[model samples]
Structures are given as C-alpha cells and as structure tokens.
Target: MTSSLSLTKKLVNVAMGRESADMVIRDGVWVSVQSGEFIPNTDIAIVDGHIAYVGGDASHTIAQDTKIIDAGGKYLVPGLLDGHMHVESGMVTVTEFVRTVAKRGTTGIFIDPHEIANVFGLKGVKLMVDEAAGQPIHVWVQMPSCVPSAPGFETPGAEITPDDVAEAMTWPGIIGLGEVMDFPGVFNAGEKMMAEIAAARDAGKVIGGHYPNLNLGTIFHGYVAAGIEDDHEGTRVEDAIARVRQGMKAMLRYGSGWLDVEGQVDAILKHKLDSRRFILCTDDSHAGTLTQDGHMDRVLRHAIDAGLPPLTALQMMTINTAEHFGLTREMGMIAPGRWADVLLVEDLNDFHPETVIAKGQVIAQKGKITIDLPSVDYPVWARDSVKLGHPLKAEDFALKTEATVGTPSAPLRAQASVTANVIGVIENQAPTKHLKLEVAVEDGEVSLPLAGGKEGGADIAKLALVERHKATGDVTVGLVSGFGFSEKCGIASTVAHDSHHMLVTGTSEEDMAIAANKLAEVGGGQVVVKDGKVIGLVELEIAGLMSTEEASIVAQKATTVLGGFKACGCTLSNPNMQLSLLALVVIPELRISDMGLVDVINFELIPVIETGK
Candidate 1:
C-alpha cells in the first residue's frame, strides 16, 4: 500500500524545491474533476507517485533526472473508474481484464467476483484478490456477500456465510461487501443477511446494493434504512431518483446488455436533480465490449450524448464515484496529494485517452499499452470445474406433466391444457415478468412451443438449469418467452448469474441436450447448437466463469458467441447476457434455478407446473 505520510513528505519537498520531482507534466490543460473547472497551461509536478504541484512553471522542481512529459495544452483529466463491474462477466481473468481496459484509460475498477464465488466460494474470491493485488491500476474488491444470491431459490456450488464475510473484510484490496444481492433478505431482516451487513458496518466499509425491485413501498424503505449506500440496478429515471432521494448513490449503468444510461440520465436532464448523487457504471461487460468498445469511456460518451455536460459526465465517472466509495483524497482529481493518474485526451466530448499516465509514469498512449504486464497463472484447481453428475441425454430437458398433479407422465394422451409459469424477459433491463400460462399437455408432457397444437403457445420455449457445482446430475426445467427464437436451436452456458449453474434455453429438445452436453464436455463455457450441430462456443477455463486466454482471443470467441445467438433466431441485442441472468434469483419477477422456477418477488421457489391444472 502507498503510505499517505511518506507521500505527503515527498510531495511537500518536491513542491518547495527542496528536492526534485520524479516527473513533471508540463503545459497541460487540466480538467479539474474536483472543482469542475479547467485550468489552461498547467504544469503538474509529481513525486513518489503523488501529485506535488498543479500550477504552471514547475521548472524549479525539475532536474535532468526527472522525466518530463509535455501535454501540449491538451485536457488532462483523471483516469476513469469503473464504479461497479464483474471481472468474471468479461470472460477474462482479473489480470487480462485490467490489461485489456487499462489502455482505454480505466485507471481504477471496483469489481465484484460473485460469479466465481458462486462456483468456488471464498477460495475463488481469494484468487481474484491475489491477482488484483498485483495490477497497476486500483482494483478494489467487494467481497461476495451472497453466494446463492437468494437462498431457497437456487443451489450454488458453495455457500458464503456471515462469518465468511467478516473474515474477508480484513483481507487486502477488499473495498467493502459486494452488492447485497439478497434484497428481500435484507428488507425482511433475514438473520444471516443482516449479520453480513452488520459485519461490513462494523468494519467501516461500504455496502453495495442490488435491489432491482421497483416496489417503492415499505420494502424499499426497509432496504434503505438497512443501509444500502449505492445501487447500480436502476433502469428508469424514477428508479434513479428514488435511490438519490433515499440517501443512496444512484449508479446509472450502461453495460453490454442493460443499456440504462439513456433512460436514467433523464433524471438529471429533465428532473434537474443534483448530479452529484448520481454515478455512472458498467455493472457488467462481456469480453468483446471491453476489448472492442470501451469501459467507462463508452459510458461517458453515451452520457454526454444523453444531454449531460461533458464535465458532469466526467464527475459521475471520477469524483462522484470516488466520494461515494469514500476514497476522495486518494483519487478522482488531478490535484496535489493525490495519485498521479491523469489522462491526456484529444477531446473531452470524444473522450479517448491519447496519453495515459498512472502513478507518475506514462503507461499507455494512442490505443496501445506501453507497460509490461506479466501473465498471471492460476492453480490447477482453478480450472476443470464443470461437473455434470452423469452424461445428459435429450430426455433430461423434457418437462413431463401427468394427468394427476405432482406426477409426471411421458408419451401423453393428447388434448389437455396445463397451467405453467414462464420467465418473461424484459429487454434493456434486468427484471423478468412472471407470466402464468395455460400450456398444452401432449403425450403426458408439458408441450413446448415447437410442438404445434390448437392451444397455440405463448411463443415461449424450454428453460433448464443443470447442476454443475456438484455431480448432482440435477436438471430443473421451466418455460420462457421474449427471445423471439423460432428455430430448432438451443443455447447453453455455465455463466448463469449469482448461482453460476448451467442454463440452457431452446425450442428443440434435441438441440437443448446437444448444447448442454457440449458445455459439460468442454468443462464449462457458452455454446449454441441448432439441430444437433454446434455453432457458437467460448471456453471459460477458470471456475467456469472466466478465461485465462489473452484478451484478443477471448474477445474473438465472444464475438462468435454473439453471432451464434443471432443464428439461433435470437433478436435481443445481447442474448448471452440474457441467458446468463436466467438463474439470477435476486431480480424480479421470475427466474429458473437448479432447485426449480423462482418467483423472485416473493423470494420463494414455485413449481413449474401449477397444481390443479
């Protein structure tokens, strides 16, 4: 850790001309994120990785030994911060993710490795922390609070208890508790959940929230009173306003799929609310988006185009995020006594960092990384984690329904309708709609949409959750709509949210089995198969949620994965993201898990087939 005391002494000496600075960035236009003002022709003096002077004419603190960078009056802003994100969701390891996004000017990231934690528990989180500790940029970790996300709704590979959270708080690089995914548990004061929150409070750390529920009733009040300081789950302007009004930081997100900045930015533009209480984040980004597009840079451009002033957008990414996390003095500015992480950008609106400096060294410039980032390796246990109990066959995905309730019969007598629950997906948002439909029962089985009949389906298909944590050989099936898929295709992945179980959704039973077995055969990853032919695949070697592959390779495979989803007749912009969230029991209204279909609003598991149909 960098010592503030030692840094202060060195910066004081450098500014007083008692000693030479380590580096001097001369003649730069400083975009002061702290004051929302621009200072032209500013010379920033740095000593021991801390800013010493910020005014012009720093020749007095410079020597031949000091490295000097001429910024040439370009806007030097603080390097960006990804306030809330998951490194595992990028399908890359922590080291790989940092190397990929750092060149695009992301100097700091607050990551929640809950996906890996769901698969490997505390050991997985420790592996991420160890890797993050060696990175060049600030990679703060929020300990995974809920391994199963919502208990009784799904089964995870491992479980995290309040004791686990209390122990992790003492670890280095731990920023706070991860997004409390169990919103219902917190609001209702579930003993274990509240104990975990109490541990973070006792340790004086922040508690990130994942309250995607739109209920502004007593539940929302109870949640806010229980102490959720920052939330990145808002998808509308009203949701953003509610968070800020309740003394919480509203983190308007623009992830790969959840494109929320456009809607929530309206809170500031139309409602004219204080922008200080709002922060911008990419809660999740796949490898392709992180490599091809940008991290916070992509978000900032969208925020600016959404009618936010350029400076206000920067504040959301830098200062607002830092203040909410209580790290203002250490970062979020180009001022003295702060880390010397500054970006020399060509245009504030375009917002690409042409020259990036972190800790007084120019690390990246012109879309290329200059620093040497050594490859970090994980142990053998980190890989080879896909465990399907037995070889899966086409029969596993078959949702059997008998004439008698609670009993399943195959090869049915035709001409019967059964009541079933379907996961209705909401586009450009996280929540799903729980729809109760009267489905056709043919040959004693709940007929899929593909099986043509007079009942005429809801355009929904079969959804299955394969237990991968243990050799459980458990496959729980449900129904879902909104993919608009209309082919004999299926997509499978082990990246299911929070629980990280194997999820497969398809119209054809044959293709669903093919996709699921393919993932198990390759340990774990994502696959799309149409008519027993594999089309798209991306291998995640670490905990079945991340890859140790180079960023370019992973991004290429991710692109292919998205292409495959399109080939399978999916029209959602990011279907893979949708597929991953199918098992996320935290958000409403319905999701499928290893246990069964979950009604997330009620925080309980519901039978796939409604009784007495």
Candidate 2:
C-alpha cells in the first residue's frame, strides 16, 4: 500500500491536538454517529479526503492554502450509507446514481449488481464496479453470488457459479458477495451455494443474506450457520428481531413500495431490541423517486417518524452500515483518518442535505450536483441485451384452448392454463403475494378480454416478459393485478427484477408488443404505450438496466412516463415499479420468470390453473 503522506501528516497533527489541515469547518453541532451523541461547537478539519480534527475551535493553526468553511451552527452528520441496493434498479448508471444520492446526503453505498449479473454474469458486475471506481462517492460493489437466482428454477441469460464468486473476490473495489437470494438452496445446503458462501468467507468478506420467508426456525438457523452476515428483506418486526438476535444486521428498507421501516423500527421501540444491529436501505428506487423525494435521507426521516430517535436512526444509516461492510476505518464517522464524507443538514427531523461532500470533494449543494461526473461507456457485449427470438404478433400472445367440438351440446367445462402464482405487488416491501386467478376459455382457446370491458375482464390482465437480452425474441405471458391500468396502455421497463429482461404490462397485446419493441429498439429501457403508440421512453443503454446520461435527464424522461401512466388511469403508487417487479421470483407468493410462473412458497413452477377442473 502506498503510504499517502498528506492525510497521514494531517492525522498526526490532529492526534497531537493540532489542526494542520487543508480545509476546516468551524462552529458546527457534530452529530457524532460514532457514540450516538451530538458534540456542540465542534470544528471538523479535512486534509486529503480524511478528517483530521473534530473538536472545539481550530482557527489557531491552519495551512496557507487551507479552505475554511463556516458551519454556522448547522448540524454536521456523517453522510448516509445504503446497506443493500442495486444501482441498476434506479434505472440510472453508477455516475447518475452517485449524483442523485449525493444530493440526499448519501455518501456511500454497498450495491449488489445481481440484476445485471443474472443477464451478463461477471462481466456485467465489472462494468458496474469500474464505473463505481470513477465516482467521488464510496460506491463499493459485491460479487453476485446467486445468479439465475435459483438454480433449476429459472433460466437466466447468464450463470455465475461459486468459481465466479472466487474470481470476483480479486477484483478491485469488490467488498463482499451479493445478496444470497437463493435461500432455499442454502437451507438445503446445496453444494454450489454452500461453496460460494465458503469462498466469500475464505476471502474474509461479508456475505449478504436475503431469506424472505418467515419460517425462522431450522431454515433460518441453517442460513445463519451458512455464514451470511446481513439481511435487508425483513418485512415483519419479528423478522427484524430474529435476524439481529441471530447476529445478522437487519436492514430496514423503504423503497418505492416497500414500507418496511415502520414495522421493523416498532420492534426496537416496543420490544427494546438492540438498535445497533439495524440499518436503513432503499432496496430499489426509481429515477423519479430519487429526484422528486430523496434517498437514504427519506429513509432516515421515515425511521425517525416511526419512533426511532434521531441520533439512533442516523447511526443505522451511517456508522452501523459502515461497520457491517468493514469500512469503519475508511468512513462512517467525522473522526481523524476517516474519509471526509460529511453532510450539513439544517433540520434533523426533515434530514434535508443542504450541502454534501464525498471524499473531501464537494459533489452537491442545495439539491444541485456541483461535480462534473464522467459517463462510463458500455461495451459491445452489454449493448445487445434485448433479444426477441421471434416477431411478436397478437397470435403469439394467444393462449390456445382445446375445442369442445364433440361436446358442444354437453356441459362444457373448458380447461384454461393461467400460469398460477400471480406475483402480488406489496406496497413498499420486496415480497410479492401468492395469488391465483382463473380466466375463461373462448372459441377453442384461452384468451384475454379486449379494452371494451368484455365478459372475462375480471379474470384477464396481460403480463409480458420481453426478451431484451440477446434477441431471443421471447415474450413470456402471465397475468397481474393491483396496477388498475384501465385502457389501451402498456408500461415496459428494462428494470425487470434480477434478470433485467423487458417487463411490459398492457391490457392489449398489440400495445404490449409495440412497447416491448420500442424499448428493444432503444437498446434497452422503459417505455409507455397508449393506443399502440409510444408516448414516453427512458433509454437505459448502459447495461439494459441504467441510463449513462445525467440523472436529471433520466428523471425528466421518467416523469413523462409517470404522467403517461396517470393519463392511462393507473392508480398504483409508482406504477412502473409495480410492473417491473412482477418477474422477481425470489420474493414470496408468486412471480413470473423467463422460464414460466414460479410459486415462491413452494419454490417450484406451478400451472396457472389447477388441473382436472
């Protein structure tokens, strides 16, 4: 390791109780997350991207070129950190993600690129890592351990075995293994998953956990025994308590539809559980949510409102997350030798980031990005993620039904195959519902009703999994609810959970086909279709999951799409987010995969309709 002299010298001065620093902020209330206390009248001096001095009045000693900033009684807190998230889920590239989160006081993130890993494997992980290395913020990556998410369950575009995890351990900027989404495999002690966890343990790195089920008995015990360190999928208060009691950090998340923070925090407030083992995360936020609302700042505010003390909530989003990822010495504090990732907030309740600095570099101020972020280019292999093996026609989406020719006069009971386990959309949570709906058969085939409120309207809704990666020309069909999109409108996104395939939802097959093709034509992205025409599109060409363009540009485009959804009578909160996650098989109840519909409860493929009806 190169012994950097600048920061070291500054730290030596601070250790001697002197402030020989390049930058100093005097007269601030330091919200010291380290000890969960606020130190009044503190001065934080910075030199070479690390804190040098953090105590009373440092005006006595300053370098000639040292820049001085007056905190002016503002509350200085450690910049927030996200414990578990996917940069691709924001539909913005790493540069854009950093720019967006920095405005919300998020100085660091531990991202799991499992979405891209499912499609492009290790190379995809490297693409995100390289881009992360370029940002001013701390954007640490985790090697995706469970690609295909569940072996023999779904067919991903790519497969990453334990060998892949070992190979990625050598990559620079890789902190640990990604979320072990294959919890069933772990519970069963599958050789491959166990080997991957073993490799991560051997590398002396963190292994992220994602056991979404509530069976916290032998199965959960098996998972904890398997060496997973942290979990962000806890929905219930008991789930949070169990994870923490088992020595795993419980990451309470508040994303687009996952309102898990309130329930989990109640566990701490009521049961008096250990709050230090908890962290905050936004598992999957859209571009619109990032720009219009905030990131971890929103999570902190929500947690505080949920009865968590302000300082305690801050620690969960800062120091606790930092310590969990083994980056305590590098960040998560305003102490000597820690990176000067600080946020100046006017109100602790609102948690608005007035000014933000990452690694001693001013990145955002007053909700504006000040730094010039570089655009990371995508390779050719990543460009052609959208694939359609065949041209989609209305006939292609038609469900064939057996003719009742001989039994026309007899009592006719048509057998319709509605791929069961409709992935239920839970608001603000990662898990889906296990719902089953049956559709009627018409004219010798199972078919959905038209836009004019036909006979089978209640039983029919269109769900399409457009093959955006590799031009396989495939569109897996299923049905969804809770969107309430009541017109000839379709929402398509490259943000399909885990696999990053194109997920399109429409009442009309023609409109769905048009929207899917439009996204594919743009390389990969999200598009809104109404009346068989494209109204809005957000091009995420970087990896079929994020736009390399500026965050503002992506936000603007996403806003238009949201408006289109509203015009199409979509009443769901963040309609596109609800649509994109319909394919995530890892979460419970029901989900559609590239292969077919998945019963997450059984961890198997189940028919959309029961047989012998």
Which lDDT tens digits does candidate 2 get at residues 1-613? 3267855876877546576677788889999888878888988877777887788977754767778888889999998999898888788888888888888899999899988888888888888889889888889999998888877767778889888899889888999998998998898999999999999999999999998888999989999999889898888889999998999999898986678888778778999988888888988888778887889998888888898999999989888999998899999888888999988889999889888988887788898889888866577877777777655676555545443433346444564433333555665556667776656666545565543343425524678776666677776777776666657677788888877677877777777778877876787778888997888888888667777777778889988888887777676677777777777788888888778788888888875554443
Looking at model 2, report the run of 10 residues with the lowest lDDT sum: 450-459
Which has the greatest TM-score? 1
lDDT of 1 at 296: 91
How well is each residue in 389-482 modelled by candidate 1, as lDDT tens digits? 8888889989987554444553334667778888988876788999988787877788766533244445788999999888889899889988
TM-score of 2: 0.94
RMSD of each: 2.5, 2.6
lDDT of each: 0.87, 0.80
**Candidate 2's error at 429, in angstroms?**
3.3
Off by over 4 Å in 2: 1-6, 14-19, 403-421, 450-456
lDDT score for residue 83 of model 1: 88
Q: What TM-score should be assigned to candidate 1?
A: 0.96
- TM-score per candidate: 0.96, 0.94
